[model samples]
Target chain A: MSNPTAAMLVIGDEILSGRTRDANMYHLAGELTNNGIALSEVRVVSDDRSAIISATRTLSETYTYVFTSGGIGPTHDDITADCIAAAFGIPIDIRDDARAILTKHYADTGLELNAARLRMARIPEGAELIENPVSAAPGFILGNVFVMAGVPSVFQAMVAGVIHQLSGGRPLLSQTMRFMVGEGTIAEPLGALAADFPDLSIGSYPFQKDGVYGTNIVVRGSDGGLIDAAMIRLSNLLPEVTDDPE
Target chain B: MSNPTAAMLVIGDEILSGRTRDANMYHLAGELTNNGIALSEVRVVSDDRSAIISATRTLSETYTYVFTSGGIGPTHDDITADCIAAAFGIPIDIRDDARAILTKHYADTGLELNAARLRMARIPEGAELIENPVSAAPGFILGNVFVMAGVPSVFQAMVAGVIHQLSGGRPLLSQTMRFMVGEGTIAEPLGALAADFPDLSIGSYPFQKDGVYGTNIVVRGSDGGLIDAAMIRLSNLLPEVTDDPE
Candidate 1:
């Protein structure tokens, strides 16, 4: 089977404005990789409707699965649910299931469920809810699009709840060999070796410091045998190959 | 001056595959914010040509500036330059000026500048080069698009070199007030306040503990006086408002 492709959409103005440093993308990438799903793309757009809709349609069409973070809160700028509904050409209203969850939580806390707070319960039609362990409010899944919360803690919980339901392919396997030699001297040989092992993906990242040069050669592939074979060949070609802590 | 909107395109399969965690987006966002530029969107696409072209065109048309990170290296997957040229309906070739810079760098290191490595010198016509201090290979600017390297160090250097060239608007100012209360309780009042202060952008981010609820309310605007005025009203209403260390 071919690799399963996934994409992420981060919707927040705080991130773009540098007020908030994003943690969701990195966390999702690591989780998706471990689950054998290849995350193919990520788009971070503001709370604007057109931007979110345009990006969602394009990415969902290109990749097998699309996961969106942020803009699902009960604030004024939180407009992801409505935009997703618009993109899919579906009707949006307060789903009874979601309303029940929020209402129960409000009752437990002895608080009034006002219109502003109830906005969290407003989900699109024909969508299944993804449990939010951090808060009673939940995210929803519509077709291949998984809409989750903006806050990192809640987003993480929703991701855990939903990742098990996804269909995934073989997880990627990688090996790294770092050498103190200059990348210029190693480029041709490494490029030729990479050509020989067409199945394995090779990357040469160069580093310089205090008049010294170094390069980290990373070999990645889904097949373990191919990855190990390429690594052996690489070690023979460049005798200085050493283990990289990273 | 009106706020200049910008977007970022991060191109690399390594990041999507979870082999490499991205640092370029955060760095660029911070630099853009400090320079008074509003970064509205960021997209991370794989090495695929069609995906790159589509994202580039969409973002470039929507924002005042588009900064791309990654896919500008010497390897085979580095196809950002070609994709960008295609997006703009322009032809691409290895220009004399870029070739000159690359040739000089290879000459200084006494390394052979092969066809594959020379791919880095190929840029769109009528583009201005962005200087790379760490490595001699430079990035370039074509109209509103600034193409940069994916490596964290090189990408940062390029952003620093090019930030001064773009015109920026009045710097966005923000004031934060934290309350030790649940977002549900504050939702009604905050929503009304936000509606009243249509000129200011107010966001409430909630956090939960073992049994405690807390939230940070952020007020943003280009006008400092307006933000301050809103903050005063918010503090008076909440009565539990306190300074947020973040």
Candidate 2:
């Protein structure tokens, strides 16, 4: 069976404006890959309601799972929850369950639950909350869309709560063969090897270190035996250049 | 006049597979911002031809400028050039000028101009080559899309060749005010400040460093005087929390 496909939507102006480098996308990508879910695409849009709504709808319909990060904070600029509701044509209010979680968490810290703080309690109708262990604010899952916090710590915690529930396929396994030769020298043979194993994804990544050029050829597939066989063939193809023994 | 909007399309499977963290998007975002071009959106898609072609078309039509990085190498996975041509309904083949550049560069190193190496010479009709000083493989520009190499050094070199040609608007100026207060404590007042200055973008980013919680309130706008005025008001509003003294 084919692996479940996923797409990520990152909503923040700080990312687009170059004020902050996004950590959530990279973390989630690694997490999803480990979970045997193929994260096919990632879209980063600014904190705009229309853009968020449009991207959410498109990704939700196109992929098996759609994960969105950011814009779910207490600040005025946090409009992701409202946008998610608008995308699904649902009404959103301060759901009692979400409010209770936030209220208790804030009360324990001796912080007032002001209007801005209460904004975190707003959730779309017919949605399930994704618990945030690091922070009190809860992420929510509406349909296939999982809405999470923008902060790296909170996003990671929320993902941990929800990832185990999703169905996953065979985890993709990868083996790397490092060679001192330039990519140009190995492209032809690598191309041929790729054609021979159509199911495996063969990637050539070039690196320059200390005035020496090298390529790391990665062979990835679900089947360990096929990948091992392909690796042996690849090492044989470049006997002198490969670092691995025959 | 509004700043010219831009979008970035990162074409790579290594990114989706969690093998590589994307550095090009962050680099380009800062470059575009400094150049007065508003980078509004960024999409990271795999090396799939259909995905690349579809994303190219969508971004090209929506934004003033579209920058694409990766999948322009000589390996089997390098399909960006072909996909770009397909997106524009243009035929691509080995152009003599591009082939000559590669041939001369390789000849200096005593490397053979094999078929795989020659693949870099393929350029779409009516496209101009963007010089890669770091590597011989040239990136191309078709319409408003500036196709760049994936390697950081080569991509930066190629961008330097073409960035001066694009029309840029006012540079986005920003000022940051740091406070050792919780975001929830100031959200209501910050929201009022945001409503007062609709033209300026006010963003509150919370950070916890060495067990101390703080928020960096950033005011961004094209007008320096307005941002300065807003900063004064902000300092006045949060005298005790702000690092700045009254």
Candidate 3:
């Protein structure tokens, strides 16, 4: 069976404005790949209500799983929870279970459960809360969409909390072979090899190091034997396989 | 006038497979921000034909400008040019200008301008070529979409060549203030402050450094005076303005 497909929706003005380089997308990409889920698409949109709601609905419907990060904060600008609720036409309120967790955690830290802090306790109707170990604020799963915080540490913790529940297919395996030449030199043979394999994905990444252009051929597939066989054919096709491209 | 809103479509399976972390998105974000073009949305899709075509159409219609990177190469996986043409129902084939550039570039480098390399010469009808100083493979501009190379150096050069042509509004300026408190501590006043300055965007980024939770308030706007005023109001709201959150 094919791996479950997923899409990531990264919501933040900081990212769009270039104030912050997003760490969450890269993190989730790696995590999802290892879990055997194919992360097919990623979208980064600013903190706009209509944009968020539309993107969430589209991604949730298209992919098997949809993971969203950011905008679930205490400040006024944090509107991810509300957008998620609006996307599914669900009623949301300060949930008792979520509030109880935040209350105990803040109390332990000697911080007040102020009105602003309590804003995080809001959950959509019929949604299940995902635990956040780093912060008391909980992420949630409404339908197939996984709503997590944008903060790197908190998003990571939430992913760990929920990853095991996701059913995965065969983990995609990759093998990289580097040649001390540009992709143009081996494109024909590489293309032919890709066609022959049919099942494996063959991609080339070019780089310039010390003023020399080289290409790294990455062969990826679920089957180890097929990947190994393709790599052997690739080696025979190339006149020379460089020990290191760097 | 509002800045020309833009979207980015990053095409690559390597990114989705977690083999490569995307660098182009961050680079373009900073460049567009400095150029006074508002990059509102970004989508990273794989090297699938339908996905690329559909994304191109949607982004082109929605935003003032759409920038696409990757999948424009000599190798088999390079399908962006064909996909872009198909998206607009335009014909694409080997154009003289692109082929001539490649011929000279390869002749100087002592590499054969073989059939695989010649694939780089394809250009959609009615598109203007974007010069790639790093490589001979020319990117193009078709209507609102600026199709560029995926390689960082090449992508940067293409952006620099095209950025001046795009009509931009006021450059969005930003100022940051650090408070030795969590966002929850100052959310009420911060929210009120954000409401006060409707022109400026006030955002809080919380951090835990040395076991102390602190928040960084970032004020962004097109008007420098308004951003400055918001910063002043923000200082008055918080009790302590820490020199550093680290």
Q: Any residue pairs clashing in model 3, and if so which?
A: none
**Candidate 1: where are CA atoms >4 Å away?**
A207-212, A239-246, B89-91, B103-117, B208-212, B239-246
Q: Model 2: residues >4 Å from true position, as ranges?
A: A242-246, B242-246
lDDT of 3 by residue, B17-46 (tens): 888888899999999999888999999999
Chain A TM-score of model 2 versus the true structure? 0.96
Can you rank all candidates by DockQ, best first? 3, 2, 1
TM-score, first chain, each model:
0.92, 0.96, 0.96
Predictions' DockQ, in order: 0.45, 0.55, 0.61
Best by lDDT: 3
Which 10-residue window in model 2 chain A sums to the lowest lDDT? A237-246
lDDT of 2 by residue, A16-38 (tens): 98889989888998898888899
Q: Give every collision pair in model 2.
A: none
Q: Ten-residue segment with the worst summed lDDT in candidate 3 chain B?
A: B237-246
Backbone clash pairs for candidate 1 read A70-A150
Q: Note each model's CA RMSD in angstroms.
A: 3.4, 2.6, 2.0
Best of the candidates, DockQ: 3
Error of 3 at A27 (Å): 1.2
